[model samples]
Target: MTASDPSGPFRLLAQCPPGLEPTLTRELAALGIPAPHQTPMAGGVMWNGGWEQLLRANLHLRVASRVLVEVGSFRARALGELVRKGRVAVDWERIRAAAGGDGRRIVFRVSASRSRLYHEGAIEARLREAGELPDVAGVGEEAEPRTRDPGEAEEFPGVAGPGDRADAPGTPILVVVRVHRDQVTVRLDTSGAHLHQRGYRQHVGTAPMRETLAAGLLLQGPLEPDGGWSRPSLVDPFCGSGTIPIEAVLLARRIPAGMASVGFVPRDFACLHWPDLPPDVWEMEVARARAGIRPLDPERFAVFGSDRDARVIEAARANAKRAGVPEEVHLATAPLSKAPHPDDSGWIVTNPPFGTRLGARKSLRPLYAALGRSVQPGGRMVGWRLLYLSADPVLDHATGLPLEVRMTTRHGGLTVRAVAAR
Candidate 1:
């Protein structure tokens, strides 16, 4: 066991969507990391922990999009200062030692905002020179050397270059340098892919709900528990690809969201490759998480989904089966006007289509009205409530229900809000 470091700089940054910081904070707490300091609007919660804590996060965090470990921060007024601060000053060996000195192939990236170092290429150049590592043998895709202009340094020594977005395996270290004014904050991305790519949904439908956003909607939205859905009859009338309902059932079952993420990057994570860490640490954690799951009571959790397209229903079924919850999910195909209601009353959560064209949007009113009526048809009302995500207020207005805005967050670069109604 690594001894505790009271004055050590080992810190993990859990990144979530903006405005969902508090929800992620409580989630980390529930998993035994106490009092995560909230970085609101930034979508990150900073907490002190070592390698094990970092591994636990990638295994457990449902709302976090990625987990970043801070490497070092320094003030650099010039390129030379940046290089010096990076290599000798920042203690690269100690940072590598944290990973137990396992040689890794580093892929470095940098971004600058409001900084005097406006030249991103120069900044990238400096980081490469400073924190250089020996290149991995026979790993990573080989590509022709990228040409450099006038004063550019020779080929990036020990760096194998940028990774292919499609095949991300063997990608260990991703150095992120964020420069603002004279300050530079360096971090290593521990989560290789976006957390929402939960590995189960090989198939997807239009405007599909992101697994991270789906998890946030299930965990943080007050309309759920407050609406008396203890076990939650999670219904997504327009359930495209079954992201919401499947995520709900997984959360209810106490299943680690990453349990079946077949190609999860935790094994390829830079620190895990380091020599000092145990080879079975990640496997043991995965096993422990598997042991920790409190499997669902067949009759306890109710999850159902329906869609206008028969194809989407078919897709949802396949996705839910791959997620190992086919028995828990019930799917059907029908237009919104003929949407089926859950026999057992449950809260409704969905990300409705955000029509980009006005004419296309106008045609969606009846769909929204059908949604409103489906929850509380005509005069028959239940204790159940509806929480749906919509991009346009004008679109939501057609639902004809008095929607109280619950939260506003971005979806697919469009500003969207989660509104609740009965």
Candidate 2:
């Protein structure tokens, strides 16, 4: 309960976009989490590790959306039972410490199905009566698994970014409660904002990709498989706001996605305020992660991006600069038809327009066809892999490539698949 008291191993879950479980597992494995400890589920990876692993997951894992710690679980068949069982099950002292010594408002996201206490509002009300808990509010409508890039900033109002004091007033602590049948489970959201809000993307264009999803595509998609953590040259012709290129460089350079990079500030997490966490532990882990970053070798590893819109190109430049890879990520303003072909065949990964409107699909056919031709101008990219996000298989066929659907996921409120011509 207190910082000095001995606590058991933390039950940690690294949540990611659905369909990225395997990728997330591999990332954890690379982070030195043993195979026996990792349990890959539908939308996240679970493991029982100590405090350092939790800090490493939040500070270094690129594809995860958030990291959560399970505090308690108990059987509560009725409201009264729920109050008694939940009160005993939850470590209220730990919660108080995590709330920075009480009176802080905690957001409770509650969901119930096939349970006796099916009323979510009543469940929250009863849970509030459990102890001298902090003021609670409901985070209405659980967010759908993020499969696409965010367009604008939706960070929590009082949350802190990197280098800022973590004890900002009104900074929220989120507690998740789920009930099924006769069982109740509770989790604490250590990630204050979504993991994709890495703080570099201050500017964005239409239909931009999320940084986490972009890293997933690069890790799992087709590539030339260069040895020793080195990746092949990456090019994104439809690179709006430069998420793919920036993530590509970050991945190859071994940069911590959530750590501060040059001009970009890092975002704060809920766990930073927990009293059980020693300040030196976080500082040491951050220092260790910073030491892991290696510079990209431009000759062997090049990342290029270009967009037809001049305005977004400027945004991409600014974003790349903030991400500490301005020189590594080359950007230009050109239509897909005029996209320059790289001398060396590597990989082309992009999120093209999905044409989600009523009849826009018909209008984008020629552009898809042009994408097929432009990348292969003069047979320069004959062996290069083309990986893209496609909402319609019909549009993929228009590219005149024998592309296979690699992974099906959501993007921009539409069902999209990562199709690839390997």
Candidate 3:
């Protein structure tokens, strides 16, 4: 069935950072997408959904990086057969419109394994020759084969590099082609830029945490109440660019990650440019999401973020302003030794220096110890839950608090774990 079908059985995939599959699955289940319909894989969660589901997945999913809609699948062991079948199996015109309309180009991101058509570049060329794909020179045509990390997401059109831009007019749409065991599956990226972008964090600090991951960490805190909404407070002692506190404010206010507080997505999504999707459908979805936003309850809840660096705190203020929650998140320039402690208990979720990014392991232990002192059993922040990202268990132990590893994931070539004390 077509994607515009109100009750279509659209095969959709929501890709996220590796090791966050379980959290992403729980998010989908909370969205009312049945567990039986979801299949959690290594890098993403696949499910059968309809038009509304597709829109909601892109708009509301806090952990997913991008959403892909499966177009078709076929068996092709040879390049020639692949092209022939792809031409018949896929809808070219719809993809063209989604790319940016008639004259826009297309980029192929091909991954092959255990199949005869192993050359991803060659497969891209064959697809272009079949007239199924628009022309894109030197896009994925690598002369030499190379290994790619499986966790890497597809590159953004204009953000990667100057040469990554399309020679033709308009933004190029990315079409994912995967060949595994002689089966070729084609899917289209519905989310244009990565969801972490959020269009607010134009300015960032060194090794800043992704907004999506920050939101996911907040989800583990004591925020959401039982079948109801509760205004919960949070603090980020190591808030670099204010991602954690900003995301916390977003969650507290029910502001969609894709949307700003005023109810508009700053950067347009690929699905919005589709020729088949009705304009009213997207408008209705945005209205529904905007209607759920609750006013900021400053008296009952508060979010504070502080860093030793003044420049990053300024950047955080700018980002919070762009996110339309400027006054809601209190940002300051201070070290972890002077982190804000509210009179009432709240959550402390942060991404601290992992030694790989900021400071030496030996020098950071004292910082972790100071952090632990602020929230340890009988400390000033007693009854507060603590969660942080740590690359070294030694550093986590330095806190002197009994912390358990909650989740582990790769960040910038380093394996980091989310350690928590509750």
Residue-by-residue lDDT tens digits, candidate 1, 124-197: 66766786754432222232132322111122233222222312333345555678777888887666555666
lDDT of 3 by residue, 197-265 (tens): 787887899988888778767766445411122325678988989998998888777787888533444
**Order of models, best lDDT first:** 3, 2, 1
Evaluated against the true structure, the overall lDDT of model 2 is 0.75
Model 2 ranges with Cα > 4 A deviation: 1-8, 134-158, 161-166, 222-231, 263-267, 375-380
Whichever of 1 and 2 has more lDDT, that candidate is: 2
RMSD of each: 6.7, 4.3, 3.8
Predicted structure 3, TM vs. truth: 0.89
Candidate 1 — worst ten consecutive residues by lDDT sum? Answer: 148-157
**TM-score of model number 1:** 0.81
Q: In candidate 3, how many Å is residue 343 off?
A: 1.0
Candidate 2 residue lDDT tens string, 337-356: 66665677778889988887
Give the Cα error of residue 394 in candidate 3, in Å. 2.2
Say what the RMSD of model 1 is: 6.7
